[model samples]
Target: MTAASIVDPMFISGASVWPLVEGGKGVAASNGTSAGAWAAAGGVGTISGVNADLIDDNGEYVPLIYKGRDRKARHEELVEYSTKGAISQARIAHELRQGEGRIHLNVLWEMGGCERVLTGVLEGAKGLIHGVTCGAGMPYRLAEICARHEVHYYPIISSARAFRALWKRTYHKFGDWLGAVVYEDPWRAGGHNGLSNAESPDQPENPFPRVLELRKMMREMGLDQIPIVMAGGVWHLKEWMNWIGNKELGPIAFQFGTRPLLTQESPIPQAWKERLLGVAPGEVALHQFSPTGFYSSAVRNSFLNELYERSERQVAYSDDPSDADGRTVFLPYGRSNHGVYLTPADHARATAWMVEGFTQPMRTPDGTLIFVAPDRARQIRRDQADCMGCLSHCRFSAWKDRDNYATGHQPDPRSFCIQKTLQDIAHGRGDPIDNQLMFSGHNAYRFGQDPFYKGGFIPTVKQLVQRILTGE
Candidate 1:
């Protein structure tokens, strides 16, 4: 393959540099060390602001310990830790860069206490962070926050409709500080995606059309000069030559979230990096199992498979016998509750599952009951009881950050605690391949075919950047 001339530099955050950026990976995957090196290579580097890791003055990793009597207290502690961690990472990234490239901090708008954490980090870090990139929700207040701090803001969006809504609602006033709009493909992106109900996960749409549509909308709104950072499924610049210098699309940049995982500077554990080499095509699955109630893409490993099985073991139920689709059947759950009403077929299925040791029946918000083994049921209850309110609203724990602080429904058993799993995977506290959520893009399988990674060769951040510029 011939290397394309990627000499067109773009100005972002007071610097004109290569229009390439490192997409932020959360839960300690993208840290200060890696982001700093990316910026040093003359590209935008993104530091994850989702419970980022921090180090002590003695050079030891500071363990995040939450000692709260309840979820509210734990949430407070989480925000404090998150803010401090972001500030620490920003300092380290700035020091390492020494004023080269640009450093952007990424956060999820759906994350618990988002406002508090954003304010805290921006207040503490000050000039260290040049821009803030937010995704996973319609962050209407992000522009205002960035403007107040005199920092640039990039709102990660999936559709033109979403961007228009943001611009019309709150961003129009602070339009100058609006750095760029990141159009992360919801169907193919790693981590939690923002696919609405109108969009089907089974059918993937072409990003070019979607992005071009976005540019059209932006131009109509007088945002013609702003760059659109295309994220998700972007592996090579050569493949995207048509998007480059296209007057209709305007200024554009590419954000890589998966390719950089194998770099030497990547903060993920060695085992996780090695696992990437073995990923084959179609190994990644996009599903709605996140506690945040949003669809996320991840490797179909043991952890994801277990969640699938748990959901499969579920059956809908009714409070009265007559509501059981006319043909009423009693599903004897436990010795005390007697059982709920179900159809004859469902009753037989439930009986079979119970015989197979799935004796524990649990209620869900959608008038369904999922049966699991006694041990698994106990674990689920424990996890729910130990909810830390990591998300603004959790499907697994039914915990909300506002009002009564409850979803007013039973916690669903199909989902698991995202915070617990992400923390475990990031810290290498358990099996890397099994037992934890492994966020990845559908294009992750290309790792095996890429010649740059032939014979299990892992490159440094600088080497990876140079190779990418070669249009490989």
Candidate 2:
């Protein structure tokens, strides 16, 4: 169960991936330096989560800059930014690679212009990128798209069944070109998760059988040689050695998401790293994101606390005449108007808090209004106008689609703009308890259980690779 026992050879498209990969994180958590460090170590490193054009002086990611008056014009700006970001990321990968490792790009399928943005980046960085990894949705055309560009592709899936669904539809045609398959644990991963309502968030199933089934499916589809990269909640080699030499699983590799957040080369704020040190097992929870309609994981901080409170207080509306309406409601402080609704003692307490300026107003993505703050509310509206229209039918947009379809009841107050929050966090304006929406694996609490990670040592990419490889 030591690191030496876990080290194994992993191959993708004739390239060797030292049995370890640094999973791609969004908003610049896994950037060139982090990915390069992994590549430098003879493993695969994925640069992801809206990569910045770090080549610009001042270390500021240039693509995030807003310009243009309309969505079309703004989208052009985004293309330019993404191109530069891709080049910058590729250059960093090449520099750190020393010509001995594999480097890949990770893109979320749900992101605005997913295919276009990724294509622009990949086209710009021709020889620099070895592969492309995508998750969050079933990328039905991924194999076709990558094949057209002659690039390798890896789809992140949670179960063997999902992979089978994809293979039957698209990847089956690409055959050997499909580089690797990533299985990220739904119950335990940072960022947007892949769980459905049918799956229980609290329960985690053994990954061994799931991986074996996926390998079997791949074999049946004539892809037995493709490696399976395990992601989410993977911290140490000793915990994973049991899967290394299993015959049913075949060639297996591991991908680390949250563990990489504490690396010196990682671009996360220092305070974020410090917070991970104090995390206990079960401290991380999987909840539905009001923004993207997907499950995501993160430490339960003030931001989450506020969201949870809102959910608890949410009341279902009924059109039946028996239902109470127009009841005396106390509005939160800074709300332009009070006396919205009140039925119970808790409603009275809410009204009291509002009168005392103890509460803020927030709007959901569905256009339902809840009081958050006058200042915060104003900021949300102002930030919404700057929207490059990154998402299709943004809930913030009171603007409708071209078909006169009322982008129906848009302008949700419950969800804040993801771009704004992520941008703020990336720029170091993040507060672990308030501003930043931190994402981690469900197993993040396991850090407290281990002695080696006591006090949350932020290791360098080199140190992480060495430790995982050596099993120290």
Model 1 Cα displacement at 453 (Å)?
A: 0.5
Off by over 4 Å in 1: 1-7, 335-337
Best of the candidates, TM-score: 1
lDDT of 1 by residue, 1-472 (tens): 2235453779987788678899999889998888998999889999999988876656568988879989999988988898999889998899887678999999999888999999999999998999999998899999999999999999999999999999999999999999999999998899988898899999999999999999999999899999999999999888998998888899999999999889999988887898889998999999999988889999999999988988888877877787527538877656777778888788888889989998888988888888899999998999999998888889899999878888887788889988888888877886555668999998999999998899999999989988888777
Q: How much is 135 displaced in model 1, in angstroms?
A: 1.0
Q: What is the per-residue lDDT of model 2 for residues 83-155, given as tens digits with 9 covering 90 to 100?
A: 5786788778878879877888888776666777787887788888888899988888888888887889999
Off by over 4 Å in 2: 1-5, 49-51, 57-63, 317-369, 393-409, 430-434, 446-449, 454-456
TM-score, every prediction: 0.97, 0.87
Cα RMSD of all models vs. native, in order, equals 1.7, 3.8
Alpha carbon lDDT at 186, candidate 1: 93
Candidate 2 displacement at residue 294 in angstroms: 0.5
